[model samples]
Target: DPVVVLDFQSLYPSMMIAYNYCYSTCLGRVDQLIEQTEFSEFGCIGLEVRKQLLYKYRNDIHISPNGVVFLKDYVRKGILPKMLDEILETRIMVKNAMKMNNKKQNPSKGLNRKLDARQLGLKMIANFTYGYTSANFSGRMPCVDVADSIVAK
Candidate 1:
């Protein structure tokens, strides 16, 4: 028997935006010492606390279990998430244009084809953002940790 599988088209990118998982949110390596090991009692720590805590924290303090700590709130928003949001938005606009154009009486094939190409390009860019970080290239930082964290998410 054959089975049909359903998947969310923009799952990865959506998760990134939802969790604010970007390079900017990364608070770098946790310290070896624990000068202050306070639970998240009051609330999630802000950027100010992040700076203070990074100096002496044995374990990951943030709410996320993805090996990387993120800012308590999306007040500033990360660069990667912002970029991905634009790309996804553009794709949606193009897709909508293509769909609406195809349903028109005239149905301009050229416009529809152009929209389709643009949508595909945006998709490739959004999907490859994660791979770009993981690629073990000399020019890049080669952050397998960040890539692995993304997978863990």
Candidate 2:
């Protein structure tokens, strides 16, 4: 028999963006043990259930324990997620440009190097996000609970 390995490149970042896992999406603490049907149809298209502390200020009516709880806030999206998305998008654009430049009849090595550097920087930032979430210092709102939740997923 042969051993096999499977890996998802940039899984955390992709998961965060796909699931809308951002600080703003967390609807505060969910006090009760949520039933399956509770808020079943409340959230966005891919809504899930999870257990969390219930905070009265946010007025979280229903609950679950799937980790993330998104709000219906039209005014703003999660700051962290938005930032990640922008970085990811920018990296994609840079990569595309790099590929295009490389395919040119007389490619400019300087331009290719700059694009590669840009994507590399973006990648480094994305990879450090998990640490950033749990960092005690520097982060404006560092929460272990939130960081744990993200990793758990």
Candidate 3:
């Protein structure tokens, strides 16, 4: 099968904005307002609304450490929130595998169950490596060593 590589620009920054509640200054101010309240019935309602909005916004931009933004706003807001769950599950699985592998316990089960997650993580890393390689190798941001490392693994 032909590889259909899709590149997302500024994936990490977007993800951070979505996942980390780092979006609008207004939202931050609203959060502060909510926190300072002395808890009235109406104030509680407003706080709840703000909290929901903040949660929704964060879900919209779920960020990964390697800087890949899982761009699915519609899915994040509606449909299903499987993307974030999958990403989190993968992270946990990878961490477990790495830890167990270090202790030589044969992490095959964890690795196999979380292959897709592992691949996603690897893809993000590979993307970064490719960027660096291109710059270092071609006078842009090339770093063949990075590419070689990703490819070798």
Specify the poorest-scoring 10-residue window by lDDT in model 2.
39-48
For candidate 3, lDDT tens digit of each residue in 1-153?
A: 899998964353233223431111112233343564443222113222345654666655433333222334444331112333444455656766666665765556555656656756754653343344335434453333222322332
* Whole-model lDDT per candidate: 0.65, 0.63, 0.39
Which ranges in model 2 have alpha carbons more than 4 Å from their true place?
1-5, 29-68, 72-76
Q: Which is better, 1 or 2, measured by lDDT?
A: 1
lDDT of 2 at 119: 98
| lDDT score, candidate 3 | 0.39
Off by over 4 Å in 1: 1-6, 29-63
Point out the higher-scoring one by TM-score: 2 or 3: 2
TM-score, structure 3 vs. true: 0.24
Model 2 lDDT tens row, 44-63 = 22234444433332453312
Backbone clashes per model, in order?
Answer: 0, 12, 12
Question: Global CA lDDT of candidate 1, please?
Answer: 0.65
lDDT, candidate 1, 17-129, per-residue tens: 77776666655333312232443221122222344555453243343454456553334577878899999998999999998998899999889888899999999999888
TM-score of each: 0.73, 0.66, 0.24
**Candidate closer to the true structure by TM-score (higher is better), 1 or 3:** 1
